[model samples]
Target chain A: MSLRPLLIPALLLASLIALFGALLLGSTPMEASRVLAALAGMADATDVTVVWQVRLPRALAAFAVGLALGGSGAALQGLLRNPLAEPGVLGVSASASLGATFALYYGFFSVSAWLVPVAAVAGALLATMLIAAAAMRTSSVVTLILIGVGLSSFAGAAMSLLMNLAPNPFSLSDMINWMLGSVANRGFPDIVFAAPFIAAGLTILYAGRRGLTALTLGDEAAAGIGLDLRRQRLLVVAGAGLATGGAVALAGAIGFVGIVAPHIVRPLVDHDPARSLIPSALLAGLILVLADIGVRLLPTEFELKLGVVAALIGAPAFVWIAMQRRTISAEQG
Target chain B: MTDSEQKFELTVEKLCIRAGGSLLVENASLDLRSGELAVLLGPNGAGKTSLLRGILGLAPTATGSVRLQGRAFGEFNPQQRARRLSYLPQRRPLAWPSPVRDVVSLGRYAWGCAPGRLGAEDLGAVNAALAACDLLAMAERSTDTLSGGELARVHCARAFATEAPLLFADEPVASLDPRHRFRIMQLIRDHVSTGAGALVVLHDVSLAARFADRLIWMKEGRITADGPPTQTLTESRMAEIYQVQADINGNHVEITNPLP
Candidate 1:
């Protein structure tokens, strides 16, 4: 039996429920009716402020970031022909985070709220273009992945050096907090700023979906099937860069969402790379929103970092998937 | 243009392929036409695969021109090229566990239907291919669950699903059992018999002799011989090229290498 007919609707519904549940969580639990009233634009001013300004924006930001990560992850996986490939695997997230950190260090955040995301998007495009150039020269998946690892390590070192050379403790703490990843204190403007980049990335990925599916047969066969492989690679790389850069700009370098989200959707979609994209985005959005709520509800003095909770949940899930793949390949072989 | 040329014809002239400063195929030329099963046979490192890749435009040509029908090979758009030919590489490990039918439908990729949403025409082609490859029963099975032979048949079905006038297959029966090897060879022969062009590479000379209408034998990046199988697969030629002793009786060939 095929579950695909039900999977998309089920995921969309689940995401909606999660978003609603997320809106109701905080220091004081609000009634669903009041939440619904806020959504319908008929709530009192205090309720409207709490629901609209605070919870709604954070929820939307989390969802948008997840959407970008998920779409970026699925596209990267298709382009590299490796299930383990993700936006972070190609160093886009790390580079974007470094760009954001540079913005904070130079006080660009104070100048214009959009400058940090702009820098992050620039950084991501730079790293992805480098990777795409390397990919053109070599057809080996291992070589491409190794190039990504090198780029990621270099970006990490650069970020560490920036933090080491901070002129003041205040800027250092701010950089540190951003690195931890969060959806807190994010206003509606942040979501608006990141949405276009994410939308462009997702559109690019969607356009390449068929070619990506054809590529599962490998490069020569894919080309025979009329897929312009070079063009396909560029679309995936550029798309992943824009999406991941925007995501990191809104919520720091949230690790593992890209890697974990696709795995969750692959089985439900019969493991078709093309079919997995939208579903993976929805699932990732749901996962991030729920994680954001959990961090808020934690009993700690300060809310836990969103990235911390995600990595905590997602890292183990990634390990489990790797182990499962090993066993499956072992049995098949 | 003549009706024959209008149908399909791929002409390679003085094609040379170089990789990493080493010449893989040197000044090899061949004309592939509809209604023919041409075999490329050679010993290891003899540039057979390189020649095949060169013809498919997967390898860069140092000094050569390839023309499809009356146009330069490079001039055709991707969809136009794909509509003309389909290729089955030697190593095709279905990366995803997509169902057999879905995998086959990917061959119709040039049609530009929405991904995973096959039209009736696409489904008809896919079913015909699955039936041709005797994989109809296994169409619903996940590719990862298939045996090596089964997976090979699935790849053939995928190539067949394209319904292109020309097909190129490199070592289609490299590591299969005899039953599967014969089945795949027969399928290729059948495809060409319907007035389609086929260029196949095979390590098994006996299979090549049985299935190919014409043979192009290569040695050290050059065509050592090209003719009917009887003329090309001569006992003396096999000894010179393969470094093996062989016996030929009528249509049968037996390789009896007298170890030095």
Candidate 2:
């Protein structure tokens, strides 16, 4: 029997538990009773401040970022009809990071905090538009993936050039921190700024979920089934752009969660792309939350960056997933 | 109107399809009525598939006027067109390992039902399609595990599930064994007998002769013959279109040898 019916609810529960764990296992660890009391607004001001002002926003930010990445990854995988497609692999996240880097290089945060995310969104939209235009020109999946690699290389070079020309050590360090990707010191304002874009992006992906399912039969068959291919491409591209941009703005640039999350949930849903979306998002959120907790718990002079921790865990998972796919395809052949 | 009295017709006029700077199908015209199964037969690269795609408006550079049931094809939106006409292209690679039932249920997409959320009517259509294609036993099997012939049947079942008035299939039985090949053709024949129309592309002349109510022979982007199978599947016509010496005995054709 298929486990799809229970997958989403289970992921939701796991995400809540992980979020609670995030709250309970911070630098200043608190008892479960104390944390619950703080959540209920029954604790003293200092405890409430620690829970509400500090851990809550950080946890929520991590979840939102993961939600964006995971949802975008599922939408893109469906659109491209490739299991490996994701914001990071498609160069969208890198482009968004370059935009954020530019914002940091120019001291845009001092001028207005919102400008950073705005610039990141603009960068993501630009990259996604380029990819979408190329997709229209070619029906070749390999060509699209190669073009994404080229785009990513160019963006990485641009970011490196920006960092190399930093005006001061402080600016260079700031750029490095942004590139490393952390949810540390994130506050309610950051979540407030990024939430709408993330919400809108996920909403768009959700609306186009059925089209993604139709795409599993390949492009010609999908169009034969009466799906408007152009419209579906637009929805996926635009949704992934907004979501990835929002994610980068929220937590620098986290990799692999997007790819790994959907891969984990796909089998549960019998590999149905439409059904994998929400479950992927929830699982990714849980992963990032757990990663954040790991980051805090590690014994180190400096707290581990969430992106670093994610890459540490996720890159291996990515390779394993790729190897598994190769084995399956070879077996089928 | 009762099902038997309902009218279904597809008309194509002066259809031209160009691809990569070369004309693939030129000035093709045809009409199909309910209770008719038309098989398109030609040699390799004879533009049979291109003509079918052109009529379906899937060819990127197709220039044609097509009408269904007396209304212009362009007047309908994509979903509405899908509701009226269902197409089965050459067997395409399945990207995901979704269950067979789920894949077939995608045929109901034009009617606004996604897989796993099918309404009673949509479920009925899906089940009927599976049963029609002899796929009910394997409905829960993952597509990735199916053999090529089974996968081809799954696709045909998907097309059948649409329940559209007109069906355009390109090489629907190309990979099937003889038994399955005949079964698929017979299924199309049965579908057409229910007051619908089907235009199937086939390389097997004998199969086409056995099942098609009408035969359309295309050679190099043009229709060379269009008539009843008995009149169109002649020895001389087969030699002209396929460059083969052939023996035609009633509805069976034996390709004797290829011309030098």
Candidate 3:
């Protein structure tokens, strides 16, 4: 009994429900009808402004970021043949964050708002190429993770250096806040900036799904099955880089949605890594929207960072998933 | 002995493959023709696997050219090469828990159609492969849950699904039970009977004597003997190359002593 036909629709429905819930929850309780009216262009000024200018774009951006991460994570797991492979684990997000922060420190955003994201994407591509090179040299998961950790630590240090060299306290705090990763005060422009890259990245990943499936039998077998190994590596690395770079550019390095979402949905698709992409993306969008709503309603001294809240939920989920995998393997043995 | 066939041939000439600046296979030349089964036998470090990989173009060769069906092996694109030959490596490499049917269908990857969107012919081929390997009942099961013998059968089924003219298997019966060893050997013979050729590596001389149409003995990166099983597994060659004293008795090789 294949459940794939039901899985995508079920996830899309859940995502829509979460998106609607997110749009209805802010400082003031906007009625669902009013939100719908504003969406349909028949609402009053305040309602229209609240729904259109404030809530909708942020929710969509959060969803888009999650979609990118989750899709990339699933694709990367297939590419690397490791269930734990993700953008964060490969240092892609961290390197992109460093690039964005570097652009901010040097006032590139003042010259052109597009510069930060462009820089971020470039940095992500560079990191992805380096990691891909290292991965090609060895198939050991621990060695790949170690290389990624080294790259991540280096990127984190570079970001810290940029903060230290800031000329003013305003600049320092600004960099710090961006590093915290939030979707607040964002408009449709962020979505516009990210959508194309994410779309392109997803297309590349989608094209490589068959090759990825062939790779489940390892490199030689994959080649014997007519998959060009170098081409598959390029597709996956470029796709993951574009998606993760665009995501970090918009949302400032939100964590764990990539790692967590795929784990949540892998079983539904019979553990086929290639088939897990869309469902994982849908579930991740729902998770991010729900987390964004939770942050808005938390009633803290200050609104929580989207990344902070996500890590708070996701880091533990990652630990639990890892432990669960260990138990499963133990039982199998 | 289909070695005289002119329609399909894989020719490896003056092949030299190296890894980490050391030669693994040197000046090895062999020909595989349709409807022939050639079993490669060698002791450990004798470069049997390297020669197989070299012939399949999976390893980098220092100086050599492999021709498949009269086309230079390197000149053929991945799809063309895959359509000409299928290789089952020594490793059991079912990493994911993909369904048995899906995994088997992956053999047709060179057909250039999506697995889920397989044409009727492709689907028929996949079904035939599953049925041929006696895995029809386990088609829906996940490959991760399969036993060692079942996994071997599934892999063999995948190779069979290619329907290519030439097959290369490295130590395909390394760790199987006696029943499965017999089954895998019979499966290879059956594949060769279908007018395709197979080059399989094995350590068991008795099994090789039973199933192989020809035997090629390798020692230290060179071909020591290449002929029919009767002529290649002589007492002196076995003693000299494999350091074993063997007695050949009517399609069975009995190793009598390990020469020190």
DockQ of each model vs. true complex: 0.71, 0.80, 0.72
lDDT tens per residue, model 3, B13-116: 98998888788998998998988999999999999988987877778654697888778988888888887788899875766778898888888889875556
Residue A43 of model 2, lDDT score? 96
Alpha-carbon lDDT, every model: 0.84, 0.87, 0.84
Name the top DockQ candidate: 2
Would you list the rank order by DockQ, best first? 2, 3, 1
- Sorting all predicted structures by lDDT, with the top scorer first, yields 2, 3, 1
Question: Lowest-scoring 10 consecutive residues by lDDT in candidate 3 chain A?
Answer: A168-177
The C-alpha stretches of model 3 lying farther than 4 A from their native spots are A167-178, A327-333, B1-6
The sequence of per-residue lDDT tens digits that candidate 2 reaches over residues B99-202 is 99999999988989788989988899999999988999999999988987788889988988888888898999886899889988888998887777899999
- Please give, for residues A211-287, the per-residue lDDT of candidate 2 as tens digits: 99999888888888899998998898889898899899989878889999999889888788998999998888888
Quote the positional error of residue B257 for candidate 2 in Å. 2.4
Selected candidate, larger DockQ, 2 vs 3: 2
User: Candidate 1, what DockQ?
Assistant: 0.71
Predicted structure 1: lDDT? 0.84
Question: In model 1, which regions exceed 4 Å deviation?
Answer: A110-112, A130-153, A167-173, A331-333, B1-6, B258-260
Task: Supply candidate 3's per-residue lDDT for A11.
Answer: 87
Candidate 1, residue A67: Cα displacement in angstroms equals 0.3
Rate residue B61 of model 2 by lDDT.
Answer: 88
Model 2 regions more than 4 Å off: A40-42, A133-145, A166-172, B1-5
